[model samples]
Target: MRLENVSVRYHRRGPWVLRQADAEVGPGEVAVVLGRNGAGKSTLLQVTAGVLRPTRGRVVDRPRHVGWVPERFPADQPFTVAYYLTAMARVAGLSAAEADRAVDEWTSRLGIAGFRRVRLADLSKGTAQKVGLAQAMLRPPGLLVLDEPWEGLDAAARDLVPLVVDEVLAAGGRVLVSDHRNETVRLPGARRWTVAEGTVTETGPDEPEDVAVVEVAVPAARVAGTVARLRAAGHQVLRVRAAGRARDGATPGVGPRPPAADDTALPDEVAR
Candidate 1:
């Protein structure tokens, strides 16, 4: 999808929140929107998600099914989690049975199964965030737009953010997310869009710095969790290989060992 010379303002004579913001994100790619509070990050995301109309310019080639998760989910609704998700699924072009199945599937996947029958207004902030995420994924869209997806989520839920992005990319879908908490380090190879003073500019990933690579020996069952932790901590994991085996050797049940303590290593920030 592409936004050409996009500009937005609340009123005709009001100041523009975004000006001539030209940006594009294609299938199988993820773009991160970065900016300080009140810097038009949410406005850009709204425009990208087709939730808000731009005062000038236009969006082209946007997908028909666009999944948008706003910064603040409206949890004051009277519908239960299951009911709300099912209704949204239908809106996303699912049949009655399909919508029921989708609601069950996503509620389970997002760890909100117990709250399926609970009213949205009664759920906690984190649980409400989970519902927000689950609804967006009930029917995968060609373009997925998230605004501060990590906000109000627990640690485990926060870790799921990258996995969701991976799922979208694997399905050849495009993703555009805005974040200020630096919690998106796990989204490897994501293009960066920095917004400042109602202007947006794209920046490619930084060049890899000279740093030592460390390999930790974790049990096979624990590898996924360990990798997620490392990535969340701003560490760039080089690769994962079987223990005591060559890089191209057959996979083993156990993980590889860590580097010797004497090895020179740079801080995780440098690697990021």
Candidate 2:
């Protein structure tokens, strides 16, 4: 899927959404979109999923199309949970019997089988979100666009979010998700696009750990080289402590231990 020069302008009160931007997502790849609220994150997903029309530019997508889980799903009618999913499948053009089968399959997968006949308005927010998610994945569209799919989900449903992600990839589907809350996902070789101020940039390496620094005692002559190597290896460096100074401040009997007896020579930080 490709979005070329896609910019959506809401009104004359200056731009409230996305600016001219380009993004390409490929099958078998999961691209997590990160941004602050009102940064056009949800707008972008809607455009990608063909749910919203852009004021300018165009979106090109492969056949087998896209699936979407919006921040809000339509369930205001007097329909049961199963009935709602069946309606979505029917809108996607499934046969009546086929749609019912699909609805049964997804409802069971999402653990909402017990609530199948329950009214959508009576279900909790988390349960409603599961129904929305199941609707999005029932046919495994070529592109999956999600806007905070994990919102309001219980712990168990939240745990299955990654599994749903894996399913999309397993079906050779590409995904673009706007995720908040600093979710830690291990998407190997996945591309990250950070959306801020309506511009998207692929971020580089993440920040380092929060451990305190204790200097490594090294030959002064090699200190600079050693520190450089350590930084390259992703370690935070602090001021070096001289070996002589260490001995000078040692607790009385602790000074001048032989190498064979110096089992505590290395500090815990360095040992690990």
Candidate 3:
């Protein structure tokens, strides 16, 4: 997808949110948008997702099926979750039976199946966010645009974000995402796009940083949770080992040890 000379403003005389912004993301690629608050990140994403029209320029070759999840899901509607999802599925071109099946599949996968009968107005922010995610994914979209997808999500749901991105990319679809909490670490190799001063700039993938490895010993049961937390916090987990084997100094189930404690070593940061 490509945006050519795209610009946006709420009012004719108001300041421009994006001006002459040109960006592109090809199939099977992911772009992570970075910016400060009110830096036009969401505006650029809206234009890219086909949710809003550029006031002056135009977007070309946007996919027919676009999955857009805004920062906050509109959860104050009166409809029940199941009914809303079913309606959205139909809007996305699914047949009645297919809509039912899709609703069942996504709600189950996102762990909101039990709330199917609950009214949207009654669901919590996190659960409502899941519903937004589920609706966007009722069909495998050709372009997936997510704005702060990790907001209001629990650990399990947060872990699923990467899996969802992978699924879209694996299917040759493009992904555009904006994040403030540094959750993009889970999405390795995504292109970086920064929006500032009504301009959009694209950068290559992150350069390799000189990071020191820190070995963290955790109980067997907590190992998985620790690794997940580290990755989620943008820390690279060099390796994880079974505590039993590490106690015996066995090499089989052990990960590579750090080189040496140096200035870059951050044991305190990793141990938590």
Please list the C-alpha lDDT of all candidates, in the order they appear.
0.84, 0.73, 0.87
Candidate 3 residues 100-217, lDDT tens each? 9999999999999999999999999999999999999999999999999999998779878888999999999999999988888767778988999999998877765555645666
Model 1, residue 33: what's the lDDT? 94
Clashing pairs in 3: none
Q: Per-residue lDDT of 1-272 in model 1, one digit per residue for the tens?
A: 88899999999899999999998888899999998899999999899888899999999999888889998889999999988998899888999999988888878878899998899999998899899898888898888899999999876788688888888889999999988777777676788999999999987766655665554677668878997778667786665665755344434543433445886554444344
Residue 7, candidate 1: how far off, in angstroms?
A: 0.5
> lDDT: which is higher, 2 or 3?
3
Using TM-score as the measure, the top candidate is 3
Better of 1 and 2 by lDDT: 1
Which tens-of-lDDT digit does each residue in 95-121 have in candidate 2? 999898888888887889999899988
**What TM-score do all the candidates reach, one by one?**
0.81, 0.71, 0.85
* Off by more than 4 A, model 1: 207-233, 236-272
List the candidates ranked by lDDT, beginning with the highest.
Answer: 3, 1, 2
Question: For model 1, what is the C-alpha lDDT against the true structure?
Answer: 0.84
